[model samples]
Target: KANNTLKEIAEILMASRSVLLFTHINMDGDTLGSSVALCIALRKLGKQAHILIEDDVAAFLRFLDKGYCTYDNHIIENPDICLCIDCGDVDRFRERKEKFFEGKQKGCIDHHVTTEPFADFNFIDPTASATGEIIYELLKELPVEVDKDIASAIFAAITTDTGNFQYSNTTKRTHLIAAELWDYGVDYNEISVELYQNNRLEKLLLQTKILEQITVFAGGEAAICGVTQEMLEETEGRMEETEGMVETLRDISGIELAIFVKEVSREKCKVSMRSKKYINVAEISQKLNGGGHARAAGCTVMKSYEDTKQEMMRLAEEYLKG
Candidate 1:
């Protein structure tokens, strides 16, 4: 029944005169690839379609051609549909939410459990590993065939989100989809190198600096670390370099939780929390206005790192104690 609903969504889109797709801020590969795949698919269906590119440059995804996706307001010359994918809520739309939805038809496809599904037509599957996975399923529902480009894009989306099939979210279904993409001639090794191994040397230096700041709390039961713009500048690394460093702290023999507080700017801090066992970082992240999977989640903090770190630890400690 759920898959039927997503098929209805594809059918509705196929009939639309025009459509625009958007994803969360600081677009990652999964969001970018999924948005692009949907845009390409919609266009192939003989509809005017385009992907809205975020103004913020996601360092990890900088290798993608900037011009591949269009971000012009002129595409909305005629009132049509707007599609939001991977993103959970309107807030994740950043500055363009108002313009994207204002006086325009709305549709959504997402895989976030916390998503409120704010679209005229919505298809959300929280169990899916990534939005790209849902997109692949939707394409299967469509009578149209999946081409090489569409296959590659969806493959990129799922691979990145599942950490190249390393994360716990990677299920047998994910592997099956991966096998199909491989049959479609997707180069898994090249994509992995470009997406994950292309980090700059500065990011490595920053990782060293960050590792030096690792703090083990309550006898290694909890760990915390932070990075500032100044620290990033000193290491000549962009904020993206801090990607999986926090999880490294979780590697400690007895640490159950690892927290990384990154100062995105003067007042905004990007807080990423991860746990291995019983600690529910999701609950702690929600208290700070963030959301993600049970083991991994994040929120943005508008306060100083000191205050934010303290409050997060305080809230997290409660879970640890319980």
Candidate 2:
């Protein structure tokens, strides 16, 4: 299955002159980094490749777009092929789904277990640690060079998604890939500092607020942290700054499940879920009409922050019991 999909994707890339690429809406490191790497590889092959991202580049990830032209309806161009990376479903594109690249051929490369076969050609690998790993293999099959920039992008994707090689998803292949990227002069220390160490004053203030309101339930087995609109306004922080804040809850001793609920609007809240072990947050997220990995997952609730926190807490407790 893997070989056939790779061959098909290679054929499509070889035949097409213009290619349109996309990722998910929230724009995490894995999605953005993988998309940028692929775009660079395709352009090196003398093909016209453009990344059509719908959201603003997260503050931490803006460096990946340094020399690339990531489009967002500002610059429009029709392409012969459309490819989505790290996105599980077409609906994940949101309104941009109907607006961009009505191409003749469409494909997707994703690592999510619950990914739907929404594209004409699909490469879905649940065991892979990151979509960037799959893209790395695919790049070898294509007649393109894996230069330092592309290697750095792939490194960022793999490193961030694997929690700096600390997550359970890290495997032998994951390390081998990192080793290869390192050989390409990926500057591991610099990337690590940029991704994990650097933080703005606003982000620190927002983190303080989130930590202050954390509540632990189920006898410290479950915890919940919240970020309201008012907190964002007070700190002048953007929604993207809250990226890894939920993991801080999981770090607390005795906490098995951690939930972070951020108010995106008056009646809508985004919930991020993390588990130390055992709990399949993906299943819980699916029940709430969202999907992701077992240990790390997320969902959006159309309710007040209080209601969303209560609902997620209930689900976490139920899962913890079983």
Candidate 3:
């Protein structure tokens, strides 16, 4: 039933002299945090390790140390292994896919339910609440000290991915791992403040704007909203500020499905979906050529925002009837 060989993966990492970690395009907390922790662990073993993230870290997460997770690979010249952390699809590499494959070896460690093996070696554990848990296990196999920095990174990854142990994917094992990481002196209090309490006023206004004009349909079982370029310009908000806005829609009473669309361009829109009770948003996303977990999923639609919104409403109506 296990989809990974932790010992074998550990051996592969140990043998490598230089390691490069690749995070996904959007650069979520799970990918960035997991990669940072793993990179630190590799370095503690006296090997050269660096994290490669093509996109800029969001303003909220910029407080994290940049030396471990960097925008450029200035130190890593020729990596012995390139590992993708919390990256489900090759598309996540975006412009950096070539750098990922350039290493002598490649591997993937992920927790997304839709992910499959796409590297030379893969440890795909959908049961894990976050890839950080897998990295924690792998670190236990390596001969390195679990210092405060590593613990803080892993804690951030697990907490964010699990919604601070609020999401359905969180398991008993998650709490146990978190408890153990606490022993290593993780600065969890600071992480919580950065993640939840440090929202900018512009972001607050933008979220308020989204909720004020949400569209309800399918007999009020579904709610939808959008972030247009015009809206961002008006509120002085960035696209990354809209990360958790869809969850607010799902939290509304009587809402079973929530959809948030962000205008990518004049003829393209990005869609994020979240379901509270029974609807499988992942199924809907796959139908639209995207994939994710049951409760959460996303897709990119090649159509005008209005057209994409209408299509999502139609799908929500159809799915709500079940």
| lDDT for each candidate structure | 0.78, 0.85, 0.87
**lDDT comparison, 1 vs 3, better candidate:** 3
Q: Per model, how many backbone clashes are there?
A: 0, 0, 0
What lDDT is obtained when candidate 3 is compared to the true structure? 0.87
Model 3 clash pairs are: none
* Per-candidate TM-score against the hidden true structure: 0.92, 0.95, 0.95
lDDT for model 2, on a 0 to 1 scale?
A: 0.85
Worst 10 contiguous positions by lDDT, candidate 2: 69-78
Residue 312 in candidate 3, Cα distance off native in Å: 1.4
Name model 2 segments beyond 4 Å from true: 1-4, 67-69, 74-76
TM-score of 2: 0.95
Q: Tell me the deviation in Å of residue 55 in model 1.
A: 3.3
Candidates in order: C-alpha RMSD to true structure: 2.2, 1.8, 1.7
Tens-digit lDDT string for candidate 2 (1-322): 2323777788878999988788898888899889889999988999888888767888788888865646555444557888889976777788668644487777889999888676777888888899999999999889887999899999999999999999989999999999999888899988888898888988988888888988999878888988998999999877788888888899898887889998988889989998887778899999899999999998889999889988888887787777
Per-residue lDDT over 119-203 for candidate 3, one digit per residue giving the tens place of the 0 to 100 score: 8888998899999999999888888889988888899899988888998989999999999998999877898999878888999
Cα shift from native, residue 68, model 3 (Å): 1.9
For model 1, state the Cα shift of residue 134 in Å.
0.3
Q: Please provide, for model 1 over 135-234, each residue's C-alpha lDDT reduced to its tens digit, 9 standing for 90 to 100.
A: 9988887766787778888888998788678777789989998898888778878777778777788888999998898878865699999998888889
Report residue 11 deviation for candidate 1 (angstroms): 1.2
